[model samples]
Target: MKINNKDEYIIIVGCGRLGSHLASLLSKERKSVVVIDNNEKSFNRLSKNFSGFTIEADAIEEETLLKAKIDKADVIVTTTNDDNTNVMVAQIAKSIYKVPKVIARLFDPSRQEIYEELDIDTICPTILSAIEFKNIIIEAGGED
Candidate 1:
């Protein structure tokens, strides 16, 4: 099938909480989305209104990405639980598949540098939560 570039094509690897939420949100925005996960049960986390495709396959496998049409993806997000898995998938999407926008969920803030060096964008929840906590403390006039 020919993918239309007019619509944003997003490929999400790992249908965990974050991945599923993103898929559902993007689907609601009417973006073309395909979610991939090894465990078929994980796909159930997606919202009932999610209008997207789900693929049950290990994202580490090249065949799985090929099936997802990685070459045609405009954006790819890797939200796997394992940091290594997320990095690997992001690298493949950016370096190999040449997807324009590649983002990976990183649990460790220290690894952000490595991802930056690889030219892959990362969203670190741990770091973000810490920043939010700091902001709240400051707003409360807590001691430094």
Candidate 2:
């Protein structure tokens, strides 16, 4: 399929494990992808697999987002380790940039509802990881 401005450009914040995997997958699918992170060390995840642009900066910063052209981005995915930062990034994407979609990775389950109230999509990796671990344990007959 042909992608254009109406197709929604994807901007992924945080270049850690999940962020890297997500960026590579999205880019591979022929979607416009931009990855950002505060620390340069996190970008190693995109070193080889990512075919998109990567920026080293804070996603919550308006300057950084502007530099990444967040105003034109159709979607924003904030996968930072900090829940507050993720929420702020999503808010800016939605309220400021008016991006159509924003997804945030939340570290604390307690703030999941708060994020939703703010109109930001939030994913709790801790809960998902725990569920996956339980499933694996069950599959392995509860063995270590």
Candidate 3:
């Protein structure tokens, strides 16, 4: 889902490297964002310019999602390093909260089909990196 609208409300699960970066970027674009993470220190990864709210909590709990206002969120993004956590939160956002757009970062390409079946969009860094590396090798005329 293309989140081109800056006015959209966004809820992000996890405040790790990827989550913090996304929250910061969306904040810069003037989107209303709420980032949730179990570790409060993780929020530190967010840029100094970030204007969004940060919540320290486990996203797996329904109460946490509720406090993040997931019900009215236009987009919910799961970027935790753990594949299970990401998919679980993404599924909740899509199936329970009925968020219009749900995006997740998946490390294991093998589990991608599960997300696809749930109709939740996933960004698999491992697969993407492999594809990029393959393209670069092909461009260099392949290895002998």
Count backbone overlaps in model 2: 0
Q: Which stretches of candidate 2 lie over 4 Å from their true place?
A: 1-7, 47-49, 133-144
Tens-digit lDDT track of model 3 for 39-126: 9999889999999999999999999999998899999999988999999998888988889888999988888987798899999988
Task: Give the better candidate number (2 or 3) by TM-score.
Answer: 3
Give the worst 10-residue stretch by lDDT in candidate 2.
Answer: 1-10
Q: For model 3, what is the alpha-carbon lDDT of residue 13?
A: 89
> How would you encode candidate 2's per-residue C-alpha lDDT over 1-144 as one tens digit per residue?
123446558999888888999888888777889999988888787747567888998777779999999988888888877778888888989988898888888888998887788788778888999999999989899575
Q: What C-alpha lDDT, on a 0 to 100 scale, does residue 66 get in candidate 3? A: 91
Q: What is the C-alpha lDDT of each candidate?
A: 0.90, 0.83, 0.90
Question: Candidates sorted by lDDT, descending order?
Answer: 1, 3, 2
Q: Write the per-residue lDDT of candidate 1 for residues 1-144, one digit (tens) a residue.
A: 123456599999999989999899889889999999999999899999999899999999999999999999998889999999999999988988899888888998888998899888888998889999999989889654
Best by the TM-score measure: 3
Candidate that scores best on lDDT: 1
Decoy 1 TM-score against native: 0.92
lDDT of 1 at 94: 90
The whole-model C-alpha lDDT of candidate 1 against the native structure comes to 0.90
The candidate, 1 or 3, that scores higher on lDDT is 1
